[model samples]
Target: MTELDVKDWLVVESLQSGIPLTDRPYAVLAEGIGMDEGEFIRRTADLEARGIIRRMGLRIRHHQAGVKGNIMVVWRVPEARIEEVGQLLAKQSSISHCYERPMHPELPYNVYSMVHAPDPEAARVEVIRLAELTGIDDYKMLTTVRELKKSTPVYQRPEE
Candidate 1:
């Protein structure tokens, strides 16, 4: 697969806010980057195929969109069943992020997942359902009372 060129990176940077909502958004972006519409579309397709760009769409802040609570759930799943439970939890649309982490001998929690909902009760319900599905009777659900920091800056430095 061909790697992303300078123009491709420029296109991605330009799309951080999302593609323009004009009748011809791609064309607008192409013109901004001094490229024709066909070239812009072709480069975007190639970037996607190569997994350089995941998707071009709206980036919504859930809290601003009526989601009042964000919960981080940690489960003490048995080693043998971690993958199964993780997969099950990941399949739920309520789960915005999910992953398995190494558990310390002193700390028994391993599998971790995140669920965002309109309220704490809704988030708790989803976590309870996950526990039932995974047969994880013991788990800790930590709801963020306040967001300290929640911004992901665009990384500009390339690894040496």
Candidate 2:
């Protein structure tokens, strides 16, 4: 991995808060961070190319966006059918994230997906739809009652 310089750290810190919601978001961000728009863009591209930044995209604030129903449905998918079932779940627009995780002895579920809707009941309906679509009914819905902390990891210069 390429080492990040001072400017790269600045760029990372500036971006941690999120890109400005504006007509010219990049320009606004670059100006705020005191860098030329082209340079800022180039540095961002370089960070991505070097694998320092794995992914960058818009993140929807589900709660603020009037999406009250958010549930994480964990499925007990057969090891052999993990891929097939995971793909089916991923195709649905309501499913934000779907992945196969290592299962614990106590918790037998392996496949997990984040489902969102307008309300909690609707979210449950979506979960049922998913269960039917994937044919994997042995599952659990983990809903968030209160979000204590939700934030991106802020990068800081390491102490020598």
Give each model's clash number.
0, 0
Provide the global lDDT of candidate 2 against the true structure: 0.88
Q: What is the C-alpha lDDT profile of model 1 across 26-56, one tens digit per residue?
A: 8998888688999888888887888877776
> Which pairs clash in the backbone of model 2?
none
Q: lDDT per residue, candidate 2, 75-121, as tens digits?
A: 99999999999999989999989989999999999999999899999
Clashes of 2: 0
Pairs with steric clashes in candidate 1: none
Model 2, position 93, has a per-residue lDDT of 97
Supply candidate 1's per-residue lDDT for 73.
91
Q: In model 1, what is the error at residue 43, expressed in angstroms?
A: 0.5
Weakest 10 consecutive residues of candidate 1 by summed lDDT? 151-160
TM-score against native, each model: 0.82, 0.79
Superposed by TM-score, candidate 1 places the C-alpha of residue 90 at a distance from the truth, in angstroms, of 1.7
lDDT of each: 0.80, 0.88
